[model samples]
Target: MPKLISQINQLQQLGLNAKEGVVYQPSRGFFKIVYQGLILPNLPAPLRYFNYISLVGQPRIPLCYNAHTITTSAIDTATVLVSNSQHSVGHLKTYSIRRQCQFDSEQYKFDKTDLIEWKIPKIHLQRLDLEMGCNLTIHISENISNNSALQWGVSDYWSTLCLCEGEVFYKGQKYQVEGLGRFRHARALHLPFLSLCFYTCQIINLNETTQLAFSQIRNQWNIILCSRLDIQEFGKPVESFTEDVNLHIHRVYPKVRTPNGKEMYLPREFSWQCKKNGKIIFELYAQSRGDYKFGLAAGYVGSFQYQLSWNEQCLQGEGGYCEYIDCRPLRWQEKNQDEKILDKLMLLQPCLYKK
Candidate 1:
């Protein structure tokens, strides 16, 4: 048990002002609420977002949405890659959009339909697809309290874990879902274009009242940039693992191509351990479930099963959500003039080339 701080309260203040995220310059921060393992009885698999939204790239010029003027020149972007399979490798439907965003103390809305609301101990998210005439809602039923606020390079991070219940309405049917949820809000003083080399995050619930969350990043030279592990238990203080921890990704799958042709590899298996004075405090090994959603701008989302040992207690076969983003440079090949001409020709005569 240690001193705890409410990170959400501080984000509330920052979200209200336009000066914090800098409307004109490049900003590197975001507010994200994710509900993973949302079991839907009506659907084949669960529902979740493939990639979280952030202020990563250069903001588009000031724009208007729904006849509403956006004072903040910065734009918010996110991609929702929903799938019917729970594994990491599969066909995915991407809902990637850039829209004018509005943020206040209570709600953060992108465009007119997608919104992340803060109700305090009960977070509500609403995503409406106007074209498809579908709606989604996820309600988190716990308080968002963090063990600590961490700093790495020029970025500051605040994360919390909780339980969630969700529902989806599509094609005149209602689907109910529930699972573990997480809230993360991060801020970077300057643009983070070159701040990170690669990032990995995994979250799993060991039991009804206990959960394990791990995040690690490396620099361009394959050095540990920053890493953290959070052990959250109900009715107790959150614990952190930062020092003297040996975290490693034991194996990685071959490079896979996204639907859009971006190529990146993913972890097949990974393990980590925390040692103090030749005694093991915690250790975990996880293997991917082979289910995933790619085509998310050099990142992928999926599920994993893990075995963990903490304080002499052993747990196995626990499943969770995992995300890996490889920011390292990918091999780039310029298309020759003949290949470029062929691409244009195919576009002009798609029917002739239909297989």
Candidate 2:
């Protein structure tokens, strides 16, 4: 833990950044506050040296959530921003938090003695009072498979940076579409992102009944998010630079990811699904992005998860191809590098983005 703090102290020297905060994001639904950005160990600043720490977490429920997270820096007496939802990572969920840190006598220590934690209460999406998105008249099935033999399709616009089509495995085979949406990763998380394979953050029913997969597709070039909610990605204009974001669900059908690996295809097709009285009038498809291929990077969940972590760290410029940090900081190298504060801070930013 002291090592984690030492590393964090080295990072605060920098002005802006983000990182993976916990050793592992709680798998069964839990929140972790990663201590990042600390002033130089021997600071000569006139006033209190302050920095921001972020918490990256997801909700365990199949519903939208209202989550609150409070973190006391490894260094005590720091006042923090407690404004983001630390829950419901899938839809209308929030990385939604921003806090101010002010240090006191015991600044380097976490308040766990008194237990500063994330309080999560499950909220069902069925309880959401608002409609999710532009309703599709498409009829889905109990099994969620295309009973009508609906080959996957995508709709794209040049103005929309998204390729309008992406693919993943469904029932042991790869399914292709003009554009399928699900949670991906940061811009660096492209094509070989996660060891060159597809990854998802969660899968749940909007009303807690129908099941679907949620993945994140980021507009790599712009760094804006193109989120995947309910199998299909919503074509929304989003600014990734902002502190707010939203994702919706597809409640009409059950989305599926095949086991094994059967391959799907794309046609030089232009099509669309229309309804006069809420029904498909004809098969609608647009010029799809050239067909592409993707699936498991190469392993089971456990092996893949670790690989992703190592990849994230590497991209973020941290050493140690593998390290699980939980409130515990890395040891200062004391190498001739001389321990720059910005370097230390950057190390933590890649762990978990604290909003």
Candidate 3:
């Protein structure tokens, strides 16, 4: 077995040997633990989508954040990795988080000047078996680049690992709950009014020997910013590069109410084509199986669990699609006669409309 796989199994077996601690209540019903650590060594560099400051202008700074999760059914193990930081002209709000269990609890606070470090915590999941659940926490830290023009805020830097003991389906195959499932996301934040950004990422596990990850980002007006694709085989990097890319939304979920009662639309299915140096490389199609919603500073974003199939060159796998769009600009209310007249006047003047 790979060293990484062996280490994960040893950690997971600790859950079976250890006693359960006081239950930790997550913001949601599921149990969650946020810690920082280097779970994998010699991983590929992350794809940079856009720099908020460079694109939008200064005093608009860039922030960067990264989150990664890995799971395996063969050994019933799950792991999460995360790192986040920011550079800005002035201090923003101080962020803090507190999680308590019967025997242990943790509180973290981040200020403007302090560079936040990743925390790794040792955690134990209770009743981790078929139809049972398990939880564990550990602390880990690593040196990462802080020079990106994009930075994710302090509060957004943490990662959560949720484990449920049950039977889950993947690629129409049934396996005992041991190991082999994963989900991950990372982002950089900036003022909503300053600019608009769109990004899509997908990972396809072709088989035990190969995997592919791809992403593309667009600006507010839907102009392409950058795109990247990376390929790996047997846990070793094979190829990685930036390319011209296009993504098409084939199905949309329509507007749905958020927790705060605001409405947003999300894509449920999409297809993409990627090209390198003017040569078409691959085409991919993906459809969502379900959606998960989470809150953000500007608004709520939704992520869809998805299954993806690509050209034979790329293979097929399952993953997720997430979207974040501020609805304030799109929101409209009833207009009176005067407002309607103004609207018509603006429409009649092409120059004014352009302005």
Candidate 4:
């Protein structure tokens, strides 16, 4: 399909200007889409397919489509590892998540961690500078494993929608993107867009890091800074995988837009958290979306033992900057707020872990 045909088909399916997606070409041989980071339930092995289409006068274009691949990253030989990771709301939980991940390809090992972070029941406007529009649906439990000894089978799906543009670093692959990027999570918000999309998620490897960011849009000026390092060691696929991470609200603010002359402006307000495992390594908070001159960071030496500057700007409005730190303690103005309530809830009813 040519770009024109693809656009036509996409508009027909997704609606005109309703949502847009920018694409990326995977780094040659290591090209593959990692669907776990998406906000859907149950990702397939053959995440997506790109068919090169060209007609008489037109050049080659990839007709991107979604499909389910029938290949496991590893064989169905399994063992188990029990993990006890901390929830963000300050809870020490112990449970056994099936060991289905193959951390080591050569050793023929399928490992599983305790849990994954669930971003839910949360106010997206709780964090400043970090603004997002995420949709969440409740998943009722179902029985998958027969013999009903424990009386539970299918757990809930914790997924959310994310539209972001920035440095998409994962599995040693870097995707510096311009334009609004839409991600449908595999096995978690895991679906595909009719539009040509590329995924280079880094979470496939536990040792790897995947960070998607948006440059700060200041005084109507925009820019971006993107650099990625890819790694392809541990992205193997599986049959059915699920996680139970708790969503906690750190702060919430009602969004407001101020009118500047003829232009109306909505300044972002936010701060929130959800934990994976036993530690609170991730928190949602905001930085100052302040007024700066020139938009070009000129002759500036900065902290973090390195320099910082913007290299490109996306024409789309999805790009913005300023890192949001975890504002847990400061986020609460109400006195006597304790993070240990979640602990009591878990202890009072441990069956909350089951369906």
Candidate 5:
């Protein structure tokens, strides 16, 4: 028993054993943090240092945001504004989110110039109560090229009282979508090779007063750059946690052919867990709910809706998870290697698939 305990200790030291308060950096840029049940005063900033990277033959892509704002009005309405500028080409894009009351619930409208447009209809279960949870439906349209558009739909049941659940659909393919909505953030990255991939994160929300956020970043050689988490409480500051996590894949779905007939394998189910001080404190088991394929560079990439079960603080709940995957080109050693790099990145984290 003592030998087993010692081995566990060694794994913890190697950043394999998950624990709250222990910061783990597997390589130069990957950072991971785990917070058991602690309520942090504030939330930490997301990937502020490594904001942009320049590749050998590609343009310098900006990974950091220059400014963002959130405003709440008296009529139970809110607005979010975010802007980012590309350093090399001086290209700038701005995103706007407007949320307002609609009937007994709310509606969130998202717009981005030359990129995307979507509307999320949210229905609260209880009248005048935001804690009971809400129902959401999302219909999105993204312009990929002058001749084509990408369309998808997602339905979500979000609750602070119990578990959350939903489904995602694209071209008649449906995937499960379930997860906690207590805390989430939008992340955007521009790769000279792959263009831009945006990540929408949703995790389990344990309680009313506590929330956590984090990100895992990687590079071209499939090296992890960062995996960081931030814990925050209502009306308080934020505390940061870091650690490495082991991802176990239980199943892989059959390959689906894209519009161009390129085959892509999507993982149907997987599990992830983290430990703190040698005891398991957090874990997630998930399966794909729906998926879609889109063109990128010379290849195509995929995204999915996930059904998630999360365990933390001796408490377990079902929730939603969304992820993106990079696939291969039709030919070998294709000129655009960014998609290959994205495919290799699935090994970095269980729930996260970005660099």
Candidate 6:
């Protein structure tokens, strides 16, 4: 395939730099954005965002907003937020936010709400609802960025894959939304609770331009340092699989409970496969779609119903969006004593017990 579209246009030109923006560099960086189903039309209900602006190590409230309205079963009423204000990420043509990143306090009052504006390939988010109304906006209008953008390892992981189109204005009516979404800006030399490990991801759309994204990062003795799978399928280009993929994680019972109450256990099924030298290039399977969105970053966000298979073709994805992040060390959700002395000084870092 033209040498895989010239190696995905040389890894999307070493991933991002069309005037790169959104500051980083003063403590393990981070900048994220995620949208699932871009803005779909399939029986409404599939709008997501797992926003973040962390700079890792430097602490002090670093934005984490989490949007909602999902399904595979259910998930709504969500618009979580967190911030330390000081402008939550901005640049790259207004990389994000415009007003009230948060501040009215006397125990939270928040006034002007929110705003995001990018111009290239048009994007325009809005958020308002602390009684200020207007609640949603979204509007994509193109939002390019593809070739499964990459850049990896040693934690300087960059990412990209966008293909949206837009129209969404709930609470005042408006529909139209496209598919496939994800964009990341990274830099993390450590701190995932100092590498105790666990992270998972999925983003499947399978219809109007087939899509399927994958992610995995284990460690804490479970190995599997990283894994990625891209796919896309419409214009025919993206199809990157890293380390031949493997992923697994099956029927973990019902447990749940987080919001600091800590409980754990989730994964009512999962699968992954991919190979090259000895054949078999695809496989996937999913299940649990009963709604979940626990304290985010600490872990939880769910919805699934997939069934991919490649070479003999078989795609069936009725809503997909998954995430399961558990970077260990929740020493009872550390009620800060300087985070339990920085979790005993990152448990005497030995790279968290050898990877």
Name the best candidate (by lDDT): 1
TM-score of 6: 0.26
Candidate 1: residue pairs that collide: 87-291, 87-292, 88-291, 88-292, 89-291, 89-292
Put down candidate 3 lDDT per residue, 191-289, tens digits, no spaces. Answer: 332333344555544553455556665443444455666565542323655656666666566567644344545556777677777877777776654
Name the 10 consecutive residues with the lowest summed lDDT in model 4. 295-304
Winner on TM-score between 1 and 6 is 1
Write model 1 residue lDDT over 248-343, tens digit each, in one string: 656667777654344556778888787778888888888877766653334666766778888788887634677777644453111222454676
Task: Give the clash count for each candidate.
Answer: 6, 67, 35, 37, 34, 1
Q: 1 or 4, which is superior by TM-score?
A: 1
**Cα displacement (Å) at residue 115, model 3:** 21
Shift in Å, residue 245, candidate 1:
2.2
Superposed Cα deviation of residue 202, candidate 1 (Å): 1.1
Error of 5 at 191 (Å): 7.4
What digit string (tens of lDDT, one per residue) describes model 5 on residues 303-324? 2223333353344333232333
Report lDDT (CA) for all predictions: 0.49, 0.19, 0.32, 0.20, 0.28, 0.45
Error of 3 at 239 (Å): 3.0
Worst 10 residues of 2 by lDDT: 319-328
Provide the TM-score for each candidate, comma-separated. Answer: 0.62, 0.16, 0.43, 0.18, 0.35, 0.26
Deviation in angstroms for 115 in model 1?
2.3
Give a tens-digit lDDT track for model 2, residues 1-355: 5544432333222111212111211211221222221110101111101111222221221110112221332211222211111111211212222233222322222232111222111100111112111101111111111111101211001111112122222223332323211211111000111111112222211121222332333211212232332322233322121112222211111212222232211122212222235543222112212211111121111000110111123211111011000110112111112344446667884567789
Off by over 4 Å in 3: 1-196, 260-262, 295-355
Our tally of clashes for model 6 stands at 1
Q: Write the per-residue lDDT of candidate 6 for residues 170-251, one digit (tens) a residue.
A: 3344546555554443443332223335677777656656666788765434445567787756545566778678876655
